[model samples]
Target: MATAAVDRVEMSEAEWEARQELAACYRVFAMLGWSEMIYNHITLKIPGEDGAFLINPFGLHFSEVTASSLVKIDIDGNKLDDSPYPVNRAGFVQHALFHRHLPDAHCIMHTHTTAGMAVSSLEGGLRATNFYACNFAGQIAYHDFEGVTVRDEEGARLLEHLGNKRVMLLKNHGILVMGKTLPEAFIKHWSLQRACEIQIATMSMGTPIEVTPDVVAVHQRDLHMAQVPGGAGAADFAAMVRLVDKIDTGWRA
Candidate 1:
């Protein structure tokens, strides 16, 4: 396994820990098949640094990402570090908008998974047919596709569409989820993907039974109430990190 180089510039313990956590997140994405080559992005804000964040180097695959290799930048996408790689401009555009505007959104993840893209193309988007889907009943948003999100102006429209919501389905594009922490973001994406997968599978079997709106509301409320501090998502993410370490420790490097 390739070892990560030590950070040449000094970083606080918290900052270093954030880098390691973000790197682990990228590795977990690769292991779970959530990464779309090097296309999509998962970005995290640097702890204690206003408007500063860490993102994967543009040319590296998620599996190849390492703590020391992550690029640090401000909200405007200007590199704050001396990394040889450039930031993916489109990724910076989208993630920067959210990180800048949303105080609670410390981590933002975007995915172009098969199921996510499939559901995004659907007319109704995610259906409230299963428990997984029900969990996002009123908490999801949808942004109309305006082609690739490379234009800086599109960030305003994206944020407008995502108003106060944690999950968003980019119509005819893919999925984006934001959270206060990396584990929260990862768990949200996993749940959203599962919901899409379940929706597609059920639809393939001809007409599917839809859950009643009242029941869906109750399920949503129950989920909100059951969410404890550092819930199952934290445990699941830690376990996945362990699995990744067991297979290849390069991510930590």
Candidate 2:
């Protein structure tokens, strides 16, 4: 667990809050069984810094992440902090590409959960066969598989496939979600993960029925209207935060 904290650097109050919230998010993922050893990552842009964001230290489990332990880096994968932990450049290549191009992508989540990877490996992608899937009627995007190594040029293609959509299924890989805030990203990932799990269960049975396209569209419209107006994902995310805090508040340190 990168025990090289010689001297924790000073950060602005805004970055400190972002760090705390993002650290909480990592713990939340751990609590929900979304972590895969030391793999996968969730990154958030520093509040008042340009070209700088927070990512998990490469060697630590999500459960061990703390606000003062996250590694800060720029869009090019260069460390902006004094933490001795390394960043997994290969895993972060795509994230850097999207963060550089998408202004509203303040928080980016990448996960290879069992169900998420299973659904992504399927040819049909995420089937709109459940309630959570309906939320992304036409919102979800898909990128064809291109092996493990992602080049800078391919990153451009990835961006092209992502377009303006916030959710994407990386075929044969995993799920990627971006949001303007950490809470928004967390909520999207939860919905996507749940939809994948339900799809797996539904398919285990007989032929599963899918909601019609027209009905799906109506469902999305009404769902948007039903939202409580103010915060995008604040309520659900706050609830999860409370849950995680009850388990352990060490992440806030």
Candidate 3:
């Protein structure tokens, strides 16, 4: 019991920063129409020797979240601190499963966007039809549907599909991303959404567009080269927060 108590306190200043970035990601997702009516979730692993994580409250929209409003929870989905808001059971199950298994995954972001959902229903899933789509080749995993995902048993199946991959295509559902930090996860989320939008637009045009394997490789190389280092998703988060601050700093209140 003492060991368990010690584990919860492992959160350091760095972990606190991760929390802030994770919170900002939620607000950005809400602003961009990626969130599904407070149904989707973005979670961050708190920095500590013991396992701890942060997730948004169940009732609040992503845009309505502040850093302090985020809830701290254990891998078992138990709340660690006092919070006025409750967590969505489905969201908790999705996030806790990943945090419990993936040591490298510090942040997990999931969404149910119109384009993403449309692509999930397709038989092809995310095809290697374009450079953006190709970026996730061999890196994306898929999980079959199992109802609303509120039960603990569903978590094992979800983790099995996720395996060691960083991105997941929740078939007939939505998109999921995991990374070492919020920036990595957010960038991946943006990429997946953009790819989905492109696929939908192209399919609507009724024209054949294709990319060769050689071109795909080149694009993959460029994508890696374009990747930035550091947990600076916080910088982008701070910028977004500043923008929101101008409109309504009620979040800070």
State the local distance difference test value for candidate 2: 0.87
Question: What does the lDDT read for residue 143 in candidate 3?
Answer: 91
Give the best candidate by lDDT.
1
- TM-score of every candidate: 0.95, 0.95, 0.87
What does candidate 2 score on TM?
0.95
Measured on C-alpha atoms, candidate 1 has an lDDT of 0.88
- Candidate 1 lDDT over residue span 110-137, tens digit each: 9999999999999999988887899888
Query: By descending lDDT, how would the candidates be arranged?
Result: 1, 2, 3
The TM-score of predicted model 3 comes to 0.87
**How well is each residue in 1-253 modelled by candidate 3, as lDDT tens digits?**
0001113254577656756666667767877778777688888987863678888887778777776778888888788876667878888887888888888888898888998888888887987776678888678899998788788888778877877888998999988888887777877888788888998888888863777778877888776456445553545555666776676554432
Pick out the ten consecutive residues of candidate 1 with the lowest summed lDDT: 1-10
Candidate 1 residue 121 Cα shift, in angstroms, is 0.5
- Each prediction's whole-model lDDT (CA): 0.88, 0.87, 0.76
Q: List the residue pairs that clash in candidate 3.
A: none
